[model samples]
Target: MVSRSRTRPITGVLVSLTAAGLLAGCVPGTSGAGSSNSAGKDTVVTDPAAMGKVTLNVLDTFSGGTDNAWMTSVVNAFEKKYPNITINRTSMAWGDAMAALPLKLKSHNPPDIVPPNNGWQSMGTLVRGGLLLNLDNYADAYGWKKSFPQSILSEHQFSTDGKQMGTGSVFGTPVARASLIEVYYNRSLLKQIGAKVPTTYAEFDSALAKAKSAGITPITLGNADQNGVTQPLFSLTDAFGAQSKISDFIYSKGDTGIAQTGFPKAVSTFKQWSDKGYLTKDYAGLASADAAQSFVNGKGLFHFDYSGSLPLKAGQSKGFGSFVLPRDDGGKPVTTASAAANLSISSKTKHADAAAAFLNFAAGEQAAELAVEHGTMPLLHANVKATGGDPLFADDVAIAQSISTNGTAVPFLDWATPTLYQTINTTMQSMLAGKSTEKAVVTAAGKDATAYAKTLGN
Candidate 1:
């Protein structure tokens, strides 16, 4: 599948559903979901009314909480501007979306726009199955190549056989551009520990020591789902040297390995934090959401997570600050994992022109602003000032721009394989519980990394 910097406007309609709960829903109607207008796939039609009235069906994982509200807000404006098109949405919580999408793509009624998921199994599976459309036509038609940077667009491409990305077929346009990992700190907690946003590892370690001395949880981590540990691991890996190989390994490229690349510091950092009393006691038992909540609730000094984690405002999150974690050896900012949030059309979409038009509009400046309004940063290059209700939005935009300038954002470690997330989580769980050695964690993950290569037939 191809990757491009595409904008996303989506949400869960209901907040109650779990990822498992998402499985019971029927597949969305695929009956020519992208049904064509007479102008054909190559047609250029910008006016919604001129393209004729149509209802675009979207199935996505944004069904609950802020995601649902944020998406509704974006669509509200989009519909007002183009009175001819209506969006019929199917929502699932992120887990549900992740669980449900593989099956959804197999349907005769597959959605025109696939709900976005970054897993190799979910995205890579579809690309390999030939289920997603090759969006080169739309890319050319919309001048999307010029709209998004090549770095952002690279991951969306997949070889026809689905064995490669970064140079091949273009699949989807991405949006909600972001840094894969950022250290979000609770403002009050930082002040209590006498900490400033650390630009170097030494400063960060010093902050941790101070926070621990103050009897505050220096960091809060929830690993119940087995995925949370990877971010810190990623952050550690980013600071390690020759970090370009980290991305290379993630992309299944030339002789690169995660364990060899960044595993040592990742384990060392975790061990140091645990021994320093910097980690929340019994953190392995908590969920990522729970840990994030605790940090926001003032139980911790820092929460290492993404920009999209907890929404922060002047009154909320007890005052907040965020910064991209710096490497122990800084030269290029190491982005352990980041990608264009890919949004693609189905090959069977008959409404290619209309679908492409919607994508085109989503890729523009207005949606970029709308993204900021909803607490997600846009992937575009345009200047959209943060409204100041939340400063994190503005901070994230600067981070995203830094990523764009640097010309690379690596994939999350979990992208190495469907199993990698589980491995990292379980390994961290073992380490936190004092049941496994750090060397063992690295050894186990490296084995899986090799297995992932075999699975990819690379």
Candidate 2:
């Protein structure tokens, strides 16, 4: 069972789904054809028998029973419509999924669909190795371009020439949308300390100081996963106006980037918080599993985590509220989003049409409703009202939609850059360990950024 911090209660627990019953039949003219033109144009399936009884090997990063249930529901829906296809789903942890994907691809029983959140960086090696099918041709013919926004579509595309990483061909379908880092607070602790929610960086710092003075730990951080640390740093970087610079340098090789300014500030700020005792004393060794538990047990005042933690929060404590991490210079909250567990089809699949049909259904509106019912934010436009799992989930969704509508929010940096996320996460771990100085970390990252920019032909 997942535990959460109670000092500042959030809302809800993560729920998963497993397979159930089948539903309906497919709409006509949605299947892929066997052959294509020189430009890889029309996707025609000459043999309907070739698509028969197709079993799609699906890889997921969800290990919980609730997640299995939700996935099973989705898979059952797809199978019902196709009737000829079966999804053999395999679930694992995020780390296991990352480490095993390459090895699995080398084996004969490689999965037809894989979920990777790091975007091109995670899938780049596969694309370069020619293991993935270029979905550009199929996407064009299927009219998927009109289905989602360009920015959303670009998340799955990659560039071999390095000029544009998420350009050209599609490789995955986003399942859920999530904000970068929403600050979760313990309402009881805040009230006990007579502290109010902060709206700006200065106010946030003040609140931290107040919490500290009241003998309450300001923040409970779990860096054992590493992502727990870097996620917050990325949010701060975006708030400080450095995300675009780092992103441009990493993905497009733009010259006027924020690597020199925003990134360093973010690193230094995190270090400063550590120095000021805003973070837990053993944060570097803290695991997310225990960190949330500690918070639920009323050990800390605030925590930084994904909006997906809403359900977990609710199951942990009774009173929890969420806020966007306050931005510096009075800027509005600028969230970072990634395709939360995208689905991709294998190029070697014999049932390309069935696979495409499944993906199309998954990306459509009906799937969004299922996702909402399962406690996940849908990638598609939906009118579902919040169930109030975590008050923060609603706040996060509002903030995300506002930023997206105003063009202030961008996709997650890791999703935008190729292989840069691992570097950043590693650097954050080193910095947190006190093995590397902030300057050293930033300088190293800057160099890597420069090299990456060069690769992009800037």
Candidate 3:
């Protein structure tokens, strides 16, 4: 169980994917051959077996406990499934890989396969530089559109101009579908305090107050690391706004999307909760994992964390139960955040057919079972049955289904800008510490978004 996609470092230079029609690059014929489409320019592979001997260099960075272990099993299974292909794999920690991946993708010898790191920094860089294989033809060839929902596949698509996301040619697929923000509560504490699980933000706020007045930490936060703060912040923001409007802003649909939006309201609520003594005051010195462990130890009443930590909750006290954060207005069930890390193919790969085959298998039923066995949510269309024996896994599946059905999955706030993760995390910490005001925090994020949008040529 883990978090996040990436945050971009500052670059004084900008690259353009639209400036030149990049499909005509040095890789192959304008229309691909082996896996080329019927038009003869696009790649088309009807059979991975026909591709013969192949070696795919895969660069994967999902390096954590459950995800890392499950990926290992998936790699073994995939290689076994395709005996003709060998996977030359190199795995790294998330941050280290993010720092090194862009340079590597731009290098002469790039990994044949790569994991999807969402946002402008990783995918956008590759897309803009024309270093990515447009997966449009392959999606049709592989029947991916029939298997994956548009809600999940939207994140993978980018226009050739790189001006839009969520619509256009398919880029790649992620390992599974999961939530980024959720309310994990100590059920015993709720029982002791005589508070029911909240279905709306008002009831939730009341529970937090009740917990605080009862001398329990209402919320356990680990802001010392700065990164984890976005989970709750994102949930709180989405709770106040319409999912569609907020999504447009997230997708950079319009200029004033955030100018008059729900973010400020969420910030105010966060600061107010801190002021009311409902949250830990020492969060600035805490690590997210340590904070989560604190919740598992039953030291805190409520902990907002990524669903990736759900299995970890299984090891904790037996009284833990989780819910996606409730909406402020009791509107439709809306998901504040979902999967960030995904899968992508390299433009330099020689075994496009085998690589595509590996990706298809990765998103298939076996991988779904692997996800469930590791205590993670499967894809929206995945056919998963068990829940890795964690009691909370069912509740997680319910929430994931809820979003897939009635609501939409929004991207995390950090994906809004290259450096916005650092900006928002730092600001949230100061705001929680009472050193920064709500206006300041919102202003910082808005400025980053505006500046980044210009760089994106929007």
Candidate 4:
């Protein structure tokens, strides 16, 4: 599935959805209209016969196997349910979407629906430029306030001026999937190294040492494109630091949030893993997909990635299992997670009702079924069967549920600034290559975030 974070490149075969159908009914009003308490904004046109004939241009990043399959099924089901609406879908890789969406949104004819990555870089910028629609009324009409967890919904919230996040009116919705960054270990590799699945930071470190002592690669990493190192580094940060401080730093909530947190320790520990030869050799030259593939092929003891990126074959995941990054004090689980991809509506579209309908349909029962059937955990809290018969999918569901229920989930650190992605990527890459220290990484990250905050007059 396409990952929500910055490090994992979204890659997949192009899938196009086209249909020929027409039914006439009422045309929706401008921006926000039709909802009773919605201030006459946000059209709540749920009736297929009342929507009239409409076509929506949807640009998405659900490109690869299960992700692609899930999107295709959902689109097909949506069109089938509403024969009056036609979906013109365009899928692209994650990196490509990041590069192209800004320009596309500014074009004379922008797509009606776009999966904008959450944060100041994509959503905030689009909101500021008035390129994205405000979906606050839609949330009210659809009862989304109760349908989604606050942690999940907050990712899509931004102020009217687009200068603040985690607050204000709703602007979008999460992809129908749930996800988090966690550790995936090969059962056979753990057994060979005489290690067990770690339940605490101490045990996790010990297992890595044990694997290294036994001449096995403890963690497989691919950082060539700079996306591979972030997941584990953030996981380690979650383990060693207070999740609150990490959240504060990412949101730029207080003065130098990372100054007293465990971030430096986390960076140092990450460097230690590199120095102790516990990671894959020549990892900087490899891509994340390749490293994940290598882990599945039994080349590494553990792999750090988003839960949905396991790439395991159907019914063949018995040899694999996953665990959340454990707290050092054995506290409740905590990690960085939001939507796999938070979706936004384009302000330039002529069919807000139709686009909103598509988004609502994605969160319904049928789409949830498609999500589970294709190996992704659905956003709705309904109990699900095994995903594609893969046990790891069960683990994914349990992990997501656990975090949403009792554990803490925070936003990604790179969301701190528009340039923080590249800043963290290059800084972490240099540290892993022994060209930079933990302090340097911390300093660089803090500086980039501070500079961005100043521009916002924070």
Clashes of each: 28, 40, 9, 6
Q: Highest TM-score: give the candidate number.
A: 3
Weakest 10 consecutive residues of candidate 2 by summed lDDT: 14-23
What does candidate 3's lDDT look like per residue over 1-458, in tens digits? 45442333323211322233322221223232112212123657757677789888988876767667778888888878778888888888765665666557656788888874676655665565555677777788878787665656666777666666656777777665564577888889988889988888888989988898889899988776675577777788778877766766766876655645588898888878777888776777888778887887777888887765643533652467778777888886566655545777777666677777888877777876777776667655434554545556677666766655553677665666567777877787777767878889889988888887886678
Higher-ranked by lDDT: 1 or 4: 4
Q: Whose lDDT is higher: candidate 3's or candidate 4's?
A: 4
Candidate 1 least-lDDT 10 residues: 1-10
How far does residue 91 in candidate 4 sit from its true spot (Å)?
2.2
Better of 2 and 3 by lDDT: 3
Query: Which residue segments of model 2 deviate by more than 4 Å?
Result: 1-54, 103-110, 141-143, 160-163, 177-179, 192-196, 224-227, 256-261, 310-317, 329-331, 388-393, 396-436, 452-458
lDDT of 4: 0.74
Rank order (by TM-score, best first): 3, 4, 1, 2
Q: lDDT per model, in order? A: 0.64, 0.60, 0.69, 0.74
How far residue 175's Cα lies from its native spot in candidate 2, in Å, is: 1.2
Q: State the RMSD for candidate 3.
A: 4.7
Kindly list the per-residue Cα lDDT of model 2 for residues 90-137, writing each as its tens digit: 999665565566456445566777765444445554554444555665
Q: How well does model 1 score by local distance difference test?
A: 0.64
TM-score of each: 0.83, 0.78, 0.87, 0.86
Give residue 347's lDDT in candidate 4 (0 to 100). Answer: 74
